[model samples]
Target chain A: MAELNRLWEKRRTDNFQMQLRYWNLIGKNSGLMFVLYAMIIIGGFYYKRWLDGLPEHFPGLLLISVVLSALSVRAPVRTFIQKADQVFLLPVEPELGGYFRSSRIYSFLVQSFVILVAWIVCMPLFFQMAGRNPVAYFLVLAAAFIVKGWNIDCRWQEQSIDDLIPLKILRGAISFLFLYSVTARLFIAVPAACLLIMLLSGAFLFHRQAARGLLKWDRVLDMENKQAMKFLRFANLFTDVPQLKHRIRARKLISSWFPVRSFDREHVYDQIFVKTFLRADDYFGIFARLTIIGMLVSYFIGNGFYTVFIVAATVYLTGLQLLALWKHPLPQALAGMYPVSFGLKRRSFVRLLFALLVIQTVALSAAGAAGMKSPAGFFAFLAAGLVAGGLFSLGYTARRIAKENR
Target chain B: MDPVLSVEHLTGGYSRQRPVLHDVTFDMNPGELVGLVGLNGAGKSTTIKHILGLLDPFEGEIRVAGRTIRQDRLGYRQKLAYVPELPELYEQMTLEEHLQLTAMAYHIDRTTFKERSGRLLKLFRMEKKRHWFPSHFSKGMRQKVMIMCAFLVRPDLYIVDEPFVGLDPIGIQSLLDLMEEMKKQGAAILMSTHILSTAEQYCDKFIILHDGQIAVQGTLEMIKQKFGDSRASLHDIYLAVARGETKWLN
Candidate 1:
């Protein structure tokens, strides 16, 4: 049991460390961080002002209750059971109840933050509208904690039974009604709590009955693997996660865009890189998403230095993400055996980067220019984008490649 | 005629302070197949890496077709194809795409590439899987892709490492036949493997490596003469050398 606890601790630490490393990478990008912070502060101020000026007839309490209860009902347990657990820990299942108890507690603690934040955010609106006493608000918080713990336990019980979709829906609907009564300050709070307790007791009985049946180890492992991959995928957005196995799709239509006609050695690498960019799910998805985001940002900001800032930032990010593509061929032995000079590979990569950045720059600058009625503003933004693209591809990317090769 | 690959006193490894291969020396001439036999960690891969110009030799030099990797890097690389022990492929690339990429890298013209790839695909019974990505390939199918790519180049030399693992019996026979055909066409092959029987049957000569150095290298007849045993099989001679039971005349 202690060994299992230690293993769980180590796995959690490693996951936490991976997230921290990528977060630090994101933090290092000062331009993106500045934009993000600026947007958040501005948005928060507007939200507070709007809340203060709420109309008298607004059902703010009902809205808050519904959203909070919806959030509270989704209590996923993070078991942290790795694939090796099946082989190594199966024989010791009798002793794992304590380990699972710890896991449930950890899940409850982690999930409680959402309910807490919802309460805090909605508290200001609640007081302005309901004119409720501070004591009553604290009661709501305490009731929320109880409901959250019950939801976590119910979810854990639900996983043991296969073909329980209807049961899950019924539980969700019942929890929503109970939470709604408490948060809406209905006279049914006491009875709602009683009903919740009865429901939870029934769930416990169901779990006990199912516990005698075979454990669904495959389903549990699959769910756990998916949970871990979600975090890894998030971290991958900031920096490369080498352990993240990339998902590939044929995308036959999109791949047809990069027709292979090159027989020359240099052109062959260029073709391969382009085809890879178009066919690889992650790279193509990142490129398309960033390009669309840059265009949208430019459109929203209307014409100004902000548009240029967004365009430049998006280009940089796209280029950075595409660096992972170069690593694709690194593991392939035939790539190393290619008779072409190393410079040729670098040159082809630079060309591809330049082409992609230039396309992004043109589309974004054109969008910005459309909003700016002045031809001078349009030409200026266009020239700036071209220059930034050139500097990024020729100078920044070249230096990075040089550093890597060295 | 010059030997296709010449490694003279080559010494190298991942780190400079402690080289894995010490003074490794050998040569493979055209129309010959030399088996590089060694145990795991015996520096077969390190030696291949050095010959492929992936690592710089700390001492001595390697020449392919009379041109050193440094003296003519592109030309030296152009004359040889390498098949690694473990297949490493672009996960996103289909079988056809991989062959096309190989053709492009080796500067084979489009017409020649199409003809050769089609013939190889038919020969390997993989015509139906030309559009299948490596993610869908079984181990033998992936190995066939590597072998097809290597043969498609039609280079003067082939560097193969553990070529028989995961191959079906038919695949193995096809590979052996292709290698023999290449040998008849005057191409040199340097293959490293642990399958001693296959090595003895197919290889024209053997370079037995032990502890980072070549313990003995010669034809079966020459090896028998050197070991003073007329009846010993190559596997027996190899085991004897590996166990340090041979007394060399040198």
Candidate 2:
């Protein structure tokens, strides 16, 4: 037991150190803090405005119930099992209760802190929607803690069972109903007895299926790897994370968006860049998200200056993120062995970046122009975006990639 | 006839101050199969890297098809194909797309690419799973993809590092048959491996590297004659040479 405790603590310490290092790097270099601060300020201002203009039927109870239940049911246990642990700890499987119990306690505290903060943020809206004091805030909070504990216990038990998606759906529905019955202080007085019955039955079914003897070590280790990978993926957007390997998804729904059909010598780099952007990982996700958010802010700002700023910022950020495409390991490994010339690779890559940046520029410029006060400002914004995007991809990005080999 | 590859006093590694390969000189003629056999850290992969132009020799010259890499960079690389020890692939690419990409990289025309890719896929028995991504592949399947891609190019020379690992018996036989076919077509092969019996059976000559140096190299008849034994197997020769090498170092 002491050996297991020591191992768990060591792993926890290592994980904390890794997180602290990346967080420090992210703070020092990425300038992400400034972006986050600006978004928060903007969000707060809009949130207050929306609250002031709130109508009678906002469905606040439904919103609170949905958000809380979703958060609770999606509880992830942070087991710090390495790949080697399966080999090293298999003989001692029956003795890992203390280790897992510690993991449960640690996860619960962290999640509770997160839930508490979310509740604090939503308090104003809760009061506003309730139309008065109604129920004590701590009473709702204590109920939240109990529900979180129940979820954490059941989720731990459920790890041993296969076909978890249907069970998860059932758990999500029960969680929502349970929170709903407990939090509706005035209008609907559903019996607390009914909610307790639902919780106990769900827990009982999950526990019985999980059968106590065998722990799915591979699944637990896989979960741990996934949690670590999520953090590493986020960190990679800021700096190069060599440990990060991008995953593949076919994205059949959006396969039509890839315009490359010819596999000629000229389209070698083009095919690689485009396929990776569309299918490999987060490059396309980040591009689409930024474009949508930029357009949304532009549409609402209605100020020519801010709209122009939004257009430039969106294009710039997308360009910066897309630069990581060149640094990917596939291109680097191919760079040496391929009979392709350095000049041809550079030209093809720059061409693709130009096309991508142009698409974003046009999309953003159109949205910005529509939000502008005058017709003349529309054309001006459009022209500016075109020139800026053109110079960026052709001149700046071209020079950067060409310098990479040197 | 001109040799397909010539390494003249090649000495280099990842760094200059402490080299991993020292004064390694060898020549590979057309329609030849040479095996590179060594223990770990014997600089087999580094030698392959230099030949592939991934690393430059610090103080010597390497010429492929009569031209140095610096003199004709693209031409020198165009005549060579490389299969790494462990496969490196684009995760999103299907097996067929990989062949297509290789064709583009090597400048094979579409008609020729389709013909060669069809034949190679049939050879490796991978035609059914042409649309499968690498994520779904086993180690043996991934190695087959690497082999198929290399053979599809039909370059003048092939550099294959440790090709026998993780391959099924059929995969191994297919690879050997492919090598034989390529040799018949006048393509030279430099294969690095530790599978001694297979190497002894297939390779026309052998280069035995020990601690970054070529300890012994020759055809089997020449090596056996040098050791004053008319019937010394490659295993006996390798063991004798390795022991002699250790004694000399001491």
Candidate 3:
């Protein structure tokens, strides 16, 4: 018993150390903690006022909280416990139960603290609108807490919530109806009907898991760790990862145009970069995703067309220019062995960088111009893109070349 | 034959405060395969880094094909090729793409690249794998790809480090055979390895580094006379030198 306690303490210490290492490296930058809390408090007060007299937008507070919670949960906290390491540390498995139990308790307290506070403060508002007695409100609130707690615990255990698809959908419908119910007592039948529906739906969720019952709690934990690790790796993309799992895709067309195949070395280099851009998923993925999202955002927001065009163009160009510098260090290993000259490589990179900027600018500007009827805005937008994408990339390329020479 | 590579009074590291490599000197002649033997962190890599000009020499210059790197950066580098300790390929590029990029960087004519790469691919037994992405390749295969690319250029000086790692015995033999062929064609090879027996058997000269400095450098005959151990093998000499049991002739 004493040994197990010691082992649990050691595991907790190790976990704490790992957390400290990450926080020390990149401190908590998520504005969700404070900003969301403030918004929730302010929103609850406004919601109470509306619920007292005008009962239409009372559900707005619930919708807002759901959005905030969803964002908070998916907010990309990158510190993941490694499953492989856990497997290696399996000799201390007995101790891990207690350790994880403590973690589960801690997580429950911290995560639900905000929701609890919000519910308490909004009690008057929920009662005023729904015209519910204390007993009814407490029962509903109890049910809400149970559902939230179960969901959060399931998530921590790394079980797929997707497995409960129908139940989840049903619950989602019920919650939406619950939100709607706050508008009037006519909606009371809706939420009251949902309460019965939820108990039934939750039974289905538990039964599905029971039918193909898993004895491998460890495996469930492993899956949870893996899910956590995946999120961490995605977050690491914006930070430094020593061993990154880079998505590699081959492009054969680029190889065909090699050896430049022509005296106009500049033209050959231009063709190579174009092929590289088209073929390489890493480079192409960045450009395509940014452009697609930009277009979509513009479509939805209905304004800021020029803003989308320029922002997307700047992102694509900056990445290309920086890539030129990174490629510089690689060529050194080959430079001494082959007849490849630094001057030629420099020229190729410079030309490629310029060509990419030029091609993208023309394609994007034309697209923007076609949609935009304002001739002055179109031309001004194109010119701004040319300066930001063209002049900036070229200037940076030149600076890199100079630095390489040094 | 004239020496293909010469490093004299070289002193450099990644930084000034703590130099990884101290004043070091060695030479490799045409048709000679000289192995650089050392323990880990003993500056074997740092020495190669200096030779490749990935690092600048703080005190002395590195000369490839009888020209200082600084005097003619392009010309000096043009004469040598390096296969790093671990092959670092562009994950997005295929085997063929790597060959193509090397050909372009070296300015090989299209016809020549096609002709040479086709032959080299068959030589390395990687003809069918040309269009395969590097990510799909195993460690041995990735190392082979790196080897194939280095050999494609046929540079005057080949700077290969830790080549035996990630190579099957067959791959190792093939690489050694290629090195021998390159040597016969009058190219110089500066290779670093922990495999002393292989170095003893194949190398025309040896440079054993200890504590980031040259401990002993010469042919077997020269080392025997200098160390006064005529019967001792290369391994013995290396151990003795590393452990400070023997003093090498300055």
Candidate 4:
């Protein structure tokens, strides 16, 4: 293995370890786990119910091919190159082939996991369209994997060439066509052979470019940073990724409601914390989306008793995510420099969180109650959710904040 | 009058087992600009953090206006402001909001805040950009925001670390001019910088920190004489100190 390959391994290992820790943090929250579990079960139940009702005229073949084509063509190539590498590693560019080769293989493997899940998802439709054959499933999957490998390799090479949008469009079309042939036809050997030929030819072209000059370090670094940011943003949905630069939008209407009145010792942290919660990094979005989702689930589940669990679980998850507001901006923020006693901060945060959670409980309860069309169930869910929300925002939160001070 | 800021035998770092700064001590008199000079990782930032009351010193006490941070946390901090090397303005805040927040944090009255912030925005030529978020601003502009926020507090003491790094020439000059004006108004400043030319030209006194200890501290003329040549530049003194680190490495 090249030295750069070892470096890549180290970078990826550290990256995965960081992600694993964040994922574990998200997992440890039992409220979130319950919500996710309920969603998956509901989703699975609906999926089978819908599948059984599929009409004979359903365009299952076209849909599966389009999905598989898109999946295979949309290959993600992550080169764990930090911006600093352009300065330090430029001298050793020629020796970087092994590093990039490892990257492609690793990305192909990682992306394959997603493709496999997608293919398995397409299984029911595929069986309906082309009759049940386990061998055919593997054969079609093998063909799609090969096409995906080619797409990843070609996409990596494409970074070297200046991307006029048309070139990207053309490459996407070419890769999609290859995967389309693999998925569209039940017989796989002909398309498999055809794909291998195209892959070889594609390699030859990129090899000629390599023979002529060094890899475009700037282009590679930019692509890597973008891909890494995409992954981090996705991961941020679960837990705070501190290194990610936050995007702040000034939502004028939403902000108008929570004005920073007087900037005094008593109101400073409260005013700012609420403003940060409402505007900074989609705290409002998470709260609103989770509340709406909880309501929708409760309404549609149509079972008043289960609506209690649904509303409780939803409010809990919403609280858990919104607590990121505290975990993120409150702790790491320069707000620490405020002259006020730190106790004031806790008091303000607790009040803000309780108020927000109370609103979520009311919103979720209204929808849930209306869905059951029973005032009794509505009050029941309202009480249940309020208790859950109150416990989370008060007792649990106060303890958590105190522990942080220690 | 007592020094506006004082540190007595401070020793601490991020980790308790492995201290980075060792017995570092300095003082800042009101209306004087003291330059803190050191190599990278030579405890300049650590020293500034201690002065800001961000980090607790294990072995010593820091005082602003004759009061330790523990004794008067709010009053102690109210007397100080800091400009970090990288502008750490809130991403969500407009330049106007940052000023307001800083003023509010220090409990500045609205009337005073408006007047001060208005003057600051004009002085930095950022009045037009008062409503712009930092994400839209270039490096120099963002740095100007940091400078404006620090000055907004109108603290008795300012702790600035490498304030010139991302600043354009004009922005740098504006900052220098502002520091000069603030000094005349009896505000003390402790600035850490690698730019020897800037320090030698602007600073009234100097502290050369080496390996977390004060290698030397005095006026530029006094430091030059200690180097055994009154005409020798501040650059020469710094290079001589940096070469000591080279000796350690080899």
- DockQ, Cα level, model 4: 0.42
Ranking by lDDT: 1, 2, 4, 3
lDDT of 4 by residue, A1-406 (tens): 4678789899889989977887788888788889999998998899888888999888776787678778877776787888888899777876877888888998899989888998998898788777897786777788778778877887787767654365456556666666666556736675665666566657676545545554677878887878877877877777767766466778878777766688787777777777787668778778877877887888888898899998888877887877777765542224666677778878888888888888988888889888889889889999989999899989898789878772
In terms of TM-score, which candidate is strongest? 2
lDDT of 3 by residue, A1-406 (tens): 4564565567657756854665554445455446768998998788666665764645644543363234223211112335564466466655555555555565455456655665676567656655667775565455455545544444443332335455455545555455344333345676677666655654655445543553244555565566445645654534443443344445455446553454233343443455555554345566665555544443344344545555456545555534733352333343334454556656766666666565555555555554564455556555666776665556866676668774
List residue ranges in candidate 3 displaced over 4 A.
Answer: A1-79, A83-226, A229-286, A289-346, A372-389, A394-404, B11-25, B58-60, B115-139, B247-250
Which residues of candidate 1, in runs, are more than 4 Å off? A10-73, A81-95, A119-255, A275-329, A387-406, B1-3, B8-25, B29-31, B57-61, B91-96, B111-145, B165-186, B219-235, B248-250
Worst 10 residues of 4 chain B by lDDT: B241-250
Native interface contacts kept by each candidate, as a fraction: 0.75, 0.57, 0.38, 0.52
* Tens digit per residue, CA lDDT, model 2, A111-200: 899888877777778888765563655666776777787778777877788768877777677667667766666334452753665576
Error of 1 at B197 (Å): 3.6
Tell me candidate 4's interface RMSD: 2.5
Instruction: Work out the iRMS of candidate 3.
Output: 3.8
Interface C-alpha RMSD after superposing true interface residues, each candidate, one decimal = 1.4, 2.0, 3.8, 2.5
lDDT values, one for every candidate: 0.82, 0.82, 0.65, 0.81
**Model 4 lDDT, residue A298, Cα:** 84
Which rank order by TM-score, best down to worst?
2, 1, 4, 3
lDDT tens readout by residue for model 1, A148-241 = 7877776776667776676667666666666667666788765466575647665565577467566677777886778778877887777767
